[model samples]
Target: MECTICKMGETKASDITVALQRGELSVLIKNVPAEVCANCGEYYLSDDIADKVLTQAEVSAAKNAEVEILRFRK
Candidate 1:
């Protein structure tokens, strides 16, 4: 796919983690699909995924949930 931002040749689909913040609320999304530009490294997310992420973030923030970072190695 062509990159909309950089207008590069072809972009690769990759899984990206997005961090969102609103007021005192913060949430991190994992494995979000995006088309990344090979040259400029620009990422684009679909509207559907953006909406889902926002919704999840709002729900989590409403509950005042804690954000934890976990690391696993094999």
Candidate 2:
């Protein structure tokens, strides 16, 4: 795929994490499919996934839930 921003010649699909926010709610998603531009380092997600993220953000906001970011020492 060609990059819309940088007009890059080559792009690849990669797994990425997207941070979504609605009001005071926020969540981090994993293993999202995205087209990343080689030249510009820009990532774009599919429309279906974007819609799903928005819906999930709304639900999360309604529940007033918070996701804790954890780190472990090994």
Candidate 3:
């Protein structure tokens, strides 16, 4: 698909790292499936993947994790 953010580039399926901060918790999930803009290096996750990531972050935060790094799990 064509990238809206960068009209010059196309988005392709790629592996990405997702970094999110929920309050004081910092979470990083690696090897996530996403649509990446070849020109701008933007990562766009699907709705299902986004929801899963958020849920993982929530679980980490609820456990009072200050810093968390994990692999993306389907």
Q: Which candidate tops TM-score?
A: 3
List the global CA lDDT of all models: 0.70, 0.68, 0.91
Sorted on lDDT, highest at the top, how do the candidates line up?
A: 3, 1, 2
lDDT tens digits, residue span 1-74, model 2 = 88888885567998777776656656776776778888988898778867775666566667778762211111
Candidate 1 lDDT for residue 65: 70
Instruction: Please provide, for model 3 over 1-28, each residue's C-alpha lDDT reduced to its tens digit, 9 standing for 90 to 100.
Output: 8888878889999999999986788999
Reference-based TM-score of each model: 0.72, 0.72, 0.94
For every candidate in turn, the CA RMSD to the true structure comes to 4.6, 5.7, 0.8
Model 3, residue 38: displacement in angstroms?
A: 0.7
User: Backbone collision count in every prediction?
Assistant: 0, 0, 0
| After superposition, candidate 2 runs with Cα above 4 Å error | 68-74
TM-score of 3: 0.94
